[model samples]
Target: MHELAIMESALDLALGQARQGGAGRVRVIRLRIGTLSGVVPEALQFAFEALAPGTLAEGAQLAIEQVPACFWCAACAREFTSADLIAQCPDCRELSGDLRTGRELELTSLEID
Candidate 1:
């Protein structure tokens, strides 16, 4: 799965950060993975576990924060979450503006030892 590659990149970043911070080991890797980011939670977790060995992230807990696919309605100037690709504004039932918070694949924080 592509999650393997993504997890590898995340591991690289975590390792770099851990080294920069002079951490002996990584305790946790917190991530914000939006729904529209196209990365499955379970797959990503498995990837992390598989790739974590022999590195600073060994035995580290992976915290994946699944972010929702959000939409913004310009007519009502409101923001809302959606489960479907075709979503309308909850307040005005109108089409929304560009998706503001979805499609996020970022490392929000890390806990190091």
Candidate 2:
């Protein structure tokens, strides 16, 4: 799965940062994964488990923060979060195409030793 490649990249980045900081190992790897990012959380976790062994992040905790999809409803003049591809404003019941968030697949931070 593509999540394997994604986890490999993330692990590389985390290891690089840990080395740069003079750390011997990585304690934690925090990621912000949006609902609409097209990446499955379970797949990613499986990838991490497969790829982490014998590396600096061998025992690193993978902390994923799931971000809900948010859209701006011009009709309602407010932002709302949902888990649907076709977002509809709750108040106005209007379809909103103004996406605000929930398309992210970012490695936010790392806890290293």
TM-scores for all candidates: the values are: 0.94, 0.96
- What would the per-residue lDDT of candidate 1 be over residues 1-113, giving only the tens digit for each residue? 79999999999999999999999999999999999888999999999989999998999999999999988888877789997666798878887656888789999899999
Cα-based lDDT at residue 47, candidate 1: 98
Residues 45-96, candidate 2, lDDT per residue (tens digit)?
Answer: 9999999999989978999999999999987789999888779998989998
For each candidate in turn, give its C-alpha RMSD to the true structure in angstroms: 1.1, 0.8
Best by TM-score: 2
